[model samples]
Target: MTLKFGDPDLEGLKFLQDDPLVITPIIGNCHVMRVLVDNGAFVDILFHNTFIRMGYNDSQLTPSDAPIYGFNHMECKVKGAIQLAIIIGEEPREATQMLNFQVVKAASTYNAIIGRTGIHTFKVVPSTYHMVLKFPTRNSVGEARGDHKMAHSFYVITLRPDRTGGQPAEDLVPIPFDPLDPEKVTYIGASLDKPLKDRIKTFLQENNDAFTWTVAKMPGIDPNLITHRLKVDPTRKAVKKKKRTYAPDRLEAIKKEVEKLLEARFIEEVQFPEWLANPVMVKKANGKWMMCIDFTDLNDACTKNCYPYQGLIP
Candidate 1:
């Protein structure tokens, strides 16, 4: 079935550009609001405040040690994880799915974030420009429109220092590894003692080549040492995805990244091959665009290794 967005989808939304798609969905009998739909996120998140407000006790959460990193590269402590049934849309058109959410204690305007895993479970197609989420139903397509006003309000709150409390002044401090080039630096704990800090600086200065400041500085491993080969099923038909167009800003970012890779000799131009995929652009928390190739089709055709390498259990 064909699912498309048109002028009708933008009927109630305000003409605010760059607004995140925020929706209110029914979670475990409660109508939860300010849930951000982020395709970039791998796992669904539930804020500690919202988790408590939902009439859930701490005992209900299963202990987990998995680390969750934010766009700033700082780890967000996970209190635990819990599975909750979430109902999206309304009436007969709605779809229900039990989702696992990682509970975080970080202060934020969003109560929850529905990530790629949840989106895939519901087979959802989200459009930030239209501010709507469309999913497949039994008969027809079901839509859950976003709250533009709430999104705008949350975005405004994010810009305010009082709401977020900002970062601590002494959290981390840059320590220059090279005195001649002050720009070549690394971060260290600001609370470290003078002797320890001096030792660390000395150690880093001695091993300056180990730190890769840029992608161009990386000297990749030799293929003869360890090479990776895709075990694609010979019987499966090769799929070539259609080229997708991107916005001007995203297009420029992709072009710049591709040029850098070319200069670094990491990627070379190739003619039409059997397998083809499109590139995806994700906005980083630091206001930078990260380009990633979509390898879904390629992965589907590859055979899974039954005897995969296993790590030691702790």
Candidate 2:
């Protein structure tokens, strides 16, 4: 049935202004935040990141054979479809629909996209002018109100280039998460099917000890499975390079990284290191510093595998 609105429904139009209409919908069963209602989109979509946040594992996703292409002509692999229970709004009014969402890994302004398929299924009419969505429930016409304030915040959260064309000017604020603690391990976003969601919660609880919360608690890899051996040429004497200096900020970052490595037992302080490799500080795209080692001298001295392995094409 086509959507019809009264004067009372049109009253909400004032909130629209220039902001995109974004709503919080109950997907699967969790109240999924930042759902964009895009009438242009042909199919419903659940972002891969949002799918995980819904406490779903890859195993639960059904494989999709079709490749989805965007308006930009970029082809994206469909992760698979997930049947989710969608609740449009809260009681005493709500419209419920069971939908198959094609899971994708692309980044977007919203967590999930309620597209044309969903619009047709739920018989929803979205009003950008009204800044709200209207749909029919069994009892009455339900509304999923758009959050104008939250929509604006999503813009700020998106990664964007600054004038210098370096790192993104804004990065997502870090959320404190503990993988080992089951209580703290709850997926903070979205609604999901209770049975399936509870199953995932139980899975995390059961395997709590399997997660390594910090580097200090790491047990490390066993030598029998795999080990790295530096094949340095003994004939060529080890080159102990002169210590390199870094800027104050870079020096602090290097020192902190070195201390972490020592604490994690990944590296140990020795009175004298035969092959001294200087620390290299590099700026990351997120405006963070990465500490690396300059092993050019060491790598140059190592013997190359001149002969190719058997069965490898030349």
Number of the top candidate by lDDT?
A: 1
User: What is the C-alpha lDDT profile of model 2 across 1-314, one tens digit per residue?
Assistant: 44665567556343333456789988887888889898878889999999998899899989886567775577876889989999997797798889989999876657999889999998888986567788877667788878867765453345332323433333322222365544444342234566765666667767767777568889889999999899887877888978777789999998889888889999888897889888877788678888777766776566443221222321
Per-residue CA lDDT of candidate 1, range 1-314, in tens? 66799998878764545678899999888999999999988999999999999999889999988789876678888999999999999888899999999999887778999999999999999998899999988868888999988775563355333422246647787878777888888888889998998899888879987987778878988999998789887987999888899999999999999999987888889897888899999887678888888776775566533212122101
* Candidate 2 collision pairs: 13-130, 28-192, 29-191, 29-192, 30-190, 30-191, 30-192, 31-191
Candidate 1: misplaced stretches above 4 Å? Answer: 163-314
**Top candidate (TM-score):** 1
TM-score of 2: 0.50
Clashes of 1: 0
